[model samples]
Target chain A: MSDSRPVFFVSDHTGITAELIGKSLLSQFPGQAFTFVSLPFIDSQEKAEIAVRRIEAERARSHLRPLVISTLAEPELRHLIAQTDSLFLDIFPCFLQALETELGCPATPALGLAHGMSDAGQYRARMDAVNYALAADDGLATERYGQADLILVGVSRSGKTPTSLYMAMQYGLRVANYPLTPEDLERTELPECLRTYRSKLRGLSLSAERLAQIRAERRPDSRYASLPNCQAELQAAERMLRAAQIPIIETTQRSVEEIAALLKQSLATA
Target chain B: MSDSRPVFFVSDHTGITAELIGKSLLSQFPGQAFTFVSLPFIDSQEKAEIAVRRIEAERARSHLRPLVISTLAEPELRHLIAQTDSLFLDIFPCFLQALETELGCPATPALGLAHGMSDAGQYRARMDAVNYALAADDGLATERYGQADLILVGVSRSGKTPTSLYMAMQYGLRVANYPLTPEDLERTELPECLRTYRSKLRGLSLSAERLAQIRAERRPDSRYASLPNCQAELQAAERMLRAAQIPIIETTQRSVEEIAALLKQSLATA
Candidate 1:
């Protein structure tokens, strides 16, 4: 049964690419249930054989063949892992082979290059973006708003902080987040500090139920976590944002990845 | 020339996975240079047509055919994107089709699900981890160290904060980072607060030159950014970590992604 089968994401590098591609692929198969285990840094022949043994043990225990999705670059190691009694899917070779043919140059594939320090400038930018995101979080560093690529505004726990951090880290964008306090929401205008940077402003909106649920996790039995309070704050925030012509992104069900992607798209167009 | 060819990561979702895979594949061909662009949320026919035209425009301007790497789900949209005059490489359909064949189920693919909120528990864990990392930054919240899945220790700008945030955001690991100042380096033993949770410790080390360069960007022409001081601090930090039997990862030319991967591996083993 699909329920009994497990999935292993094997890679010679971080196993991140393998995991991402595998997750997207498996999400297409919603009817099945599977447990996932990631085995990273399996670069050597010995480690590859050990991975094979682990796959075999898992298969024998579950009485079903497991799915092995790998990003292994070394041919010898990939061969060793592919010999196991499972459905082995190696991602790079087929695509890279086609790319090599098109580009008319053989690829010198190596481990640790996927997420390594290949582009020093981009690497530095990502690190700086993370620091900027931290330093300018929650309206503390509104003075540095001029350097911001985007400023995310929302009520508390509406996902401004996480989305800000994700955009900074993933896209290397200088992102700053400002929380719209109840006092600011009470006013019919946007915060004074955010007015000059209106071009960089984006609003995040969350459903009252989800807001209350998330707030309850942080502060239970408080006025802050009450449903009516959340609803009022959200309504005021949306009203102020729409009046100012700042676009609002509803983030009740979207992940930080989706939010960051939409932000990047908007930044490019703007 | 190879430098003229451009690469486009086209996707219906976040385009993160497509970019990651494309970068790794292109990194193998380091002898060449290429420009990279990501076109996300290309889910509809109109957007797909726009992306194709953009690719075509880039190719025409550069006098070199561009590479289009996509994670599009719908066959119709994929066909539209593939008809572009370039090397079109669609990742998910190939792998997902094979997986569907293996599972004996017809795949019902959809958009916006790759990095979407599929598992609520995981989404919550990732959010909590990001908050934990921020709260515990620079040993600010020592009392909360009890809940940390891992603790990173290093000198200033030795790649502690970014790595901690990345581990939290990517893997949902509650990571705390402690910086060893000169005062702590002058002593022969570890800091009093860190003494109790030595088992959860991991050290990050950077080359003195790299450390100085990074610090100089923050505080120029100061003793804190001096190379000699950096060398002394790194030496003392490495010695203390070795004495405490904490594994040190040298991140001279590595990125935060690599550092976090190594930490995850160490955690799995430890």
Candidate 2:
């Protein structure tokens, strides 16, 4: 009996690039159950044989040809992997050749260089941004508010922390988020520090029902997680955002990537 | 003169997939100062027109043709964007057609569906992993040790936290990390609790010089940040990991993505 649940992402490096591309493509066909198998750092012929055997075994057992999404840079390794008894989708060779033609220059086939520590400065900046986000989370690092590239404010569970962390990790953007508490919402205006950085402020909001459900998971059946309380808090937060005249985004139906990308676009335009 | 610093990642949806691919490709060409502009959610003809105008303006001002890496799904929008004077690399069309040919199926042109909140279960699981990572950071949530998918042990600044977060965010893996304190390193045997879950443990180690440099940035010249102290701590941690017979990877020259992928591979194989 063949199991049709395993999907392979193989690469000579971290396999992240291949996984991202593979996952995006697989997501379009969403009904199938997928068990993602990441085989990274496959830089040798021996390792490539192991991967081929694994894929073959999966194919033999499942009665379905397993899909292998590969980003291997070396021609010989890629050729070897392509010989597996499965549907192979090598992501790099096609695009790399086309890009070489477009640029009229041969690309340096560098292995393990896609996401390595080649740029120490950029790595440090990213780490620093991550630390800043952790410190400034939930209005804790108020003194460093001025250093923030963007200040996101919203009610709890509005998807602020993840957005901030995504921005920091992906773009090295220094993001600080403050949760809108009852005291802050009681007053009709934004916080004083937020006012000073008003131009850089972003707001996130979600559906009251969704907010209540999320909070219920954390603290069940309390006033803090009640639907009525969610409604009132959201109403106050929306009113404060309107009073401030800042750009607000709804996270009810959007993913964290969408929210972060929207914020990045606004920052570029501003 | 057109500005050469701006690089645009254009997409009809979240633009994250395009940005990831573009950033990975661009990082190969080091020494170029690049400013990234993400133009996401361009679902309408009017919005596409706005994006074209923005690209043209950048091209006209900078005197250099701007590079536009796009992931637009709609044919009309992709065709419209390719008409711009700038150099364009549409990431989806080139591969989608090939994939369609390979799969013997026509892909529906679905806009904004790649990274949306369509799978509530998967989204919730990812978020739960994130919350779990945060709660279990620095040995804080010891009660949930049995629930962890992987336990990472390392000295401070050995790249445990970010790796844990990346695993949770990218792959929805519940990761808990414990810093090997001096007290723990002074002991001969593994911690009592860790011994129970030794099969699920992964270790991280880094070069003493690099570790010292990273610590010096956070806390300057103190005993905890001193080179000798870092050397001794790392030596002790490495020995303990060896004595415990758990797998360990060095983070001295690798990115968080690489470390996480290595661990993921180990998990899959185990």
Q: For model 1 chain B, where is the 10-residue window of minimal lDDT?
A: B106-115
Q: What lDDT score is found at residue A243 in candidate 1?
A: 98
> In terms of docking quality, how is candidate 1 classified?
medium
lDDT of 1 at B251: 91
DockQ-derived CAPRI band for the predicted complex in model 2: medium
Per-prediction DockQ: 0.76, 0.56
Candidate 2 local lDDT, A160-254, one digit each (tens): 98888888887789999999998999999998878899988999999999999999999999999999999999999999999889889998988
What value of lDDT does candidate 2 attain over all alpha carbons?
0.84
- Please give the lDDT score at residue B121 for candidate 1: 89
Question: Model 1, which residues run further than 4 Å from truth?
Answer: A1-3, B1-3, B56-62
Model 1, range A155-254, lDDT digits (tens) per residue? 9989998898899888899999999999999898999999999999999998999999999999997999999999999999999999999999989889
Candidate 2 C-alpha error for residue B248, in Å: 1.7
Per-residue alpha-carbon lDDT of candidate 2 for residues B68-166, written as tens digits (9 for 90 to 100): 888887889988888998668777665566656655566666775767777778877888898898899887887799999999999998999989888
Clashes of 1: 0
**What is the DockQ (computed on Cα atoms) for candidate 1?**
0.76
Candidate 1 lDDT, B1-270, residue by residue in tens: 445689999988899989988988888887777889999989899999999889888988987788999988888999998988889888977777778878889887868576888887898899899999999999799998889999999998888888998999999999999999999999979999898899899999989998999899999999999999999999999999999998999899778888898999899889
